[model samples]
Target chain A: MHYFDCCDFTIASEIAWPVSFPASREPEVEIRYRNLPTDLGEGGERGFRFHAKPNELLICVDGVARYLIRGGKEIWIEPFPHADEDSIVAFLQSSVLGVLLLQRRFLVLNGGVFNVDGEGIALVGCSRAGKSTLAAAFQRIGASLFSDELCAIKQDSSGRMMAWPVLPALSLWENTLIQQGGDVTKLRPIRPSIRKYLVPTHAKSLSPVPLTQVVELKDYHGDLLWKTVDVKEAITLVLGNTYRHRFLIGMALKDAHFLQSTALIQQSRFYIAQRHLTVTSEDAFFHFVRTNLAL
Target chain B: MKSIVWLASYPKSGNTWLRIFLENLFFATDEPCDINNLRSSFMSCSLDLFDHECGWDVSLLSHDEIDRLRPEIYTYIDSQWENVKYFKTHCAYSFTGSGEAFFPDEATKAAIYLIRNPLDVCISYAHHRGYSDYDRIIAEMADAASCLCSDTDQPFWQARQKILSWSLNVESWLSVEGFPVLFLRYEDMKNNPYEAFSRVAAHLGVNKSELEIRQAIKNSSFEELQKQESLNSFKEKPSRSKKFFRSGQNGMGYAMLSRSQVASIIANHGQIMAQFGYL
Candidate 1:
């Protein structure tokens, strides 16, 4: 048995995870290896890979595995015959973990969070919006990465938004690795036949940090246009970028998600950072964020 | 329950022009529709849509894996979408390794397949890709394995589009049996905008008057599109390409290509070319 600390939850699992930090506390969640039913039966919303209800969700990857997460407390995994271990674990860390957090009613965005000085700054966007790349650049420039690919957020007693730290490594494409001046030939791909690699950062925070700013990276061809968004726009932006937002309606958490977004925007300043597609250097990105966020 | 109408084409065809025309026809106004804010049609290969509907980060999935789930994703979208949604795609009509159609019949209303001459596609596609080599472009159009955004080295905002060769792409759409497909030649669109666009409006069941159709045609004219592109740069313009709306002329293929390049394209796609009046 292995225990890991992730997103403020101590999880006990049958499979050892390389990404999360080892936990020494009583577990709040349990991951077990068992056979999952092919069908969840009627009366729930269905997606390509998942079936969601108010308290349960099932994620099925044809050749990888079927994962059933219930009530944010237990995860049942059924690995397919001859499934690649790395691919199964990758899904477990990404989609499985993300759904569990949402089941716990936490506000999760599909992006990365990095600690700048003592505060957490979230860089959120859809895929290829340079979230992981910018987070990697921030790490190189002395910021501590809290998580990448999924940013789970919560609130303290004083109503301040806090970012719960997850995995310490960043999943970067081969081109990004090359641009970051790292040797690609030495690192193993995240999964066999995939070009993305998991590169551990020099600095990472295990504890939660105050999330002060949320920046949405947009891909624009022309000059970089950075602007602060009002609360209404921020709510829309945050909801649009929410991780697995389609699951909200199916899980009957639409109102909760909205309340979370409203609460988050109240605490964190939101901005849209349109990065010029032509700007390729890491230093340029680091300088841009530093100048815009005044970090 | 079919709700999706696919604006399917090979690269550099009149897909964008048709989309702009439809936008003007449906949402008529004093000014032309913003090329950036195209509310009429959404991209079928959008990374965000896949992530939202599939409930997984597409970056973590392989191209084949994503392709396998595409039909289910479309079904999910169709279930929730209220109106008849138009989706633009460059992917050729094909099936996944699991023997399922990429565009499922249950979710697909119809497909408006746009075909340009391989000879001309060679010219426009070279520009769109920022390549000066006509020989390389012709070779890719002939190779059946050609695909768009299939590189694994970097992530893309759009999903991997399996375009195949120019001839194969056109043939694939023309041969689909499950759904009705309306094939519109790019040459016909240029030479006879009235008849071609009228056919498009009728096929889409848009109840626009004759005057509205004419006005939409005028509003989305090649010149107007070029002017708009100049005034406000098109978001769809490739990072490498200078402009999205290049010369929309008919025979740039013959004008630019060397004798050997023209012969190579003709040799590869002569059958489809002759059938479509390109011969």
Candidate 2:
């Protein structure tokens, strides 16, 4: 069991560290998190809590607390139950690094992100709704990519809003990968139903860009249409498309910070994009995004 | 003797409309139609509730397990809701290992089945749920229709199939001896509300004056249901963000389907579709 201590908590667990997180000694803000025990059918429940100076984020499962540490860059989770060494390394590179890149505190769901730009544009839609598809498009057209899937949004000491990268790579479908001339060998097998690959974003493209517009891609009858919607509609749409894990909704409802952050997100611009009914290739979608969106 | 009424249909095939018609006619309330209330008031049974009560673990269950448990679960459900129940189901006509029966053994209070042209069903399902291709959707419908006819337990391939199987299940229940059965076509419901709702009322053994039935029809109209604030809100998680009520027009599917695909659906499920005057 590995023991970690910070502030008022300590955690020990049998699950080995599959990946190493780069340690930080400089103390800016300190937060503590400990894993909790669980009885869920899948095995034991694993959970953690975070305590900052004035605020605390507690996540407990079955009943045991595991790892408690003061805040550093960000909390990195290396997808647990790694069977082999290479998988651990991949987990560290893909998942742990992904979390560190996030400049602000944020939630990750189904490995996707619903980020609102500074200008109030919220990109919201379902899985395979071309969020990464459009993000790749923006990248190709010279728009700095903040995050491919998850992003952190926090208020600085000056009370100014900022967005940060969460994941270093964007997942692309086979069709999108082929369109962007991506290396298929780097692609990881996600499932039998669909093909998925991770494409690394350029380090230069890592900086936070002001969010100006929100676009939602919907598949309709063979036609591309775009319409701007007000904030209320955007909020409803974004909430609908959010990484909707069951616990996430409960968390969003109870946490004031989460609610405030989401409310801030609501103030941005929103659009509902009905993508082309039949596109011969991903280029068609990118072209449509380029021609229509200001980005 | 307890009576169980099943309100079954292929998805988006006017099941809601029929429910509205029945609600307005039976409740005799001037208050606008509220689908959420209507669903809860009628004692509707869905998978969500079933999973919570039985610890059935539906997500992990295999296809065979699902098939074996389907009928037994419904039987248990039928017994539980034996009092004035308006049960809702999406299962196609098939044996659930409760014997080779199409529906529960108890005497039905009423069985109303709503059907539409499979072509229309395919098109509507595709557009409404983001189905990418038509051929896959049609194959799915065909498989479901066959499953319904055979009374064999099989998982549905597509949403369209589920819808078609619902119609078939209703038809099978209607065919059972000594049960009050009513068949309402989506097209007829669209064109003539009075005639369709009157038939529904007669089947329900409710004696309403023509004026009352007319009021019920008017109250249950798609325009009115759409305007009602209650019907627009859903209590379930991952709330349906889009307008639940879309174009209630019949034959809107023709605009999207090729002539050949339309012909194929008709050819495969023509007898059942024609029975409900869908042709």
Candidate 3:
């Protein structure tokens, strides 16, 4: 089995994953390649090709594979015939990983996290909100990469909310790679057909760090604006940016998710940063973040 | 279980106008409802809604993959939503790669299709897109594979909608056998507001007094809409566009297009336009 350290947990997977950190402890989670049950019996929420129960979720992406995540401990994947390794691995890294984190009760954000100084500052937003772009920029200026795409956070025994490190790769579009002064043709695409290239980071944080700020990046045509969120709004922002938050209700973790968000908000700062799409420069964004956040 | 009534139309048609009218009709406020804050209708292709309802990141999925899941997402929303919901869409009535209807009958109560003359639509569409490329717009209108928000290079907040061509869009909605479709013309709505909107009220079973209809028509008039737009810019307006409610006239568009431009539209959509009295 291939062993890796992800989300502060030792993951022993039968399928090879592209994470950077090696497992330092015994396995807390096991990923096996097995045939998942076709049905979940009854009383579960369903999407087009998936079903979700309180502690189990069966996701079937046509032509890719079927993944059954159960009880936060194990993930069973059944790949479709003729499916490429990249496609299967892409789902495993994203949606399957996200479901597993939710089952483990971590406050996961669908964005990237980076270590600024010693604190974990998360940049959360919807898809294409420039989270990876900003994280890449932060890393260029000496910030250490903690996570990309999915950021998992949990309260440690010391009552400090910590951002758990995930895979040490950032998936960036072609334009973003060019803008970041990287050669796109040399980088491999995340999936064979997709234009997004997976750029591996050299400076990766393996251990969890104390979580401090969660900034929601917004793409707008107007001037750059920053809105300071109150604790109540901060809770909403955290929940809204939570990775696949719609699954919380289906998985019967709405109350638990809300509580986790409340606790996270109590310890961390939250802000909504609107970046002008056309006029604002990347340097301007970095300066704004550095100035307003005092990083 | 079906609670959604689609306000389906092509771009720059009377879809927004009908939405405004419905907003006024339902609330019956002293003053007109805010153009930016219309609660009557929601867009069908909102990416955030898709992401929330489908319990996944849509950006990770291919456009065809997203299309396959849209029916199920809409059904989920229909099951959860209590009241009758009106969703505005610029998508033509079409099926996914898996042969599933994009606007599934199981989740749809009915539909209101607002069709306009292609000649006028071309002019308004150019303005709405903040461009004056009439020839390009004309060509796009005749291309069967035309769509809205189809850009793949950049991230957009809305999902892609395949609207097809002018004739195909009209034909597709007209051929729907699963649910009732109240096909209204933009010209008729502008000319006979009472008769046109009364049909709208009847189709959706929104019973209103005669005075209510009159007041709603007055509140949703082109002048009132223009005035409201001038006061506070409409949120749906493209940033490059100067105004959203620009000259809600009929024949003015026909007069503006070149002789060849009008002939091209007639050649492309002659049959459909004639059927709708637009010719």
- Which candidate comes out best when scored by lDDT? 1
Question: Which residues of candidate 2, in runs, are more than 4 Å off?
Answer: A1-122, A126-128, A175-186, A192-194, A202-212, A216-249, A252-255, A262-289, B1-112, B116-192, B198-279
Compose the digit string of candidate 2's lDDT tens values, residues A51-121. Answer: 11211122211111212211323332223342343333233333333222221244332223223343323
Q: After superposing candidate 1 on the true structure, give the runs of residues whose Cα lies further than 4 Å from its correct spot.
A: A41-44, A202-205, A276-283
Clash totals in order:
0, 24, 0
* True A-B contacts kept by model 3: 0.11
Estimate the Cα RMSD of every predicted model relative to the unseen true structure.
2.2, 10.6, 2.9
How far residue A50's Cα lies from its native spot in candidate 2, in Å, is 20
What pairs collide in candidate 3? Answer: none
- TM values, all candidates: 0.94, 0.51, 0.90
Interface RMSD (C-alpha) of each candidate?
A: 2.1, 13.2, 3.5
- Quality of candidate 3 docking, DockQ: 0.26
Model 1 error, position A186 (Å): 3.3
**Share of reference contacts found in each model:** 0.63, 0.00, 0.11
lDDT of 3 at B49: 73
- Tens digits of per-residue lDDT for model 1, A251-284: 8888988888888988899998886554445567
Per-model TM-score (chain A alone): 0.95, 0.60, 0.94
Per-model lDDT: 0.86, 0.50, 0.84
- Candidate 2 on B1-279: residue-level lDDT in tens? 336677767666777777777778777777655655664234233433433233211222223434554444555555555455676555554454446543555635667777777777786666555566887767766664443212122212111123344345555555666466676778888888788878877876778999889888888887786666343342221122244465667776688888898887787777876666666
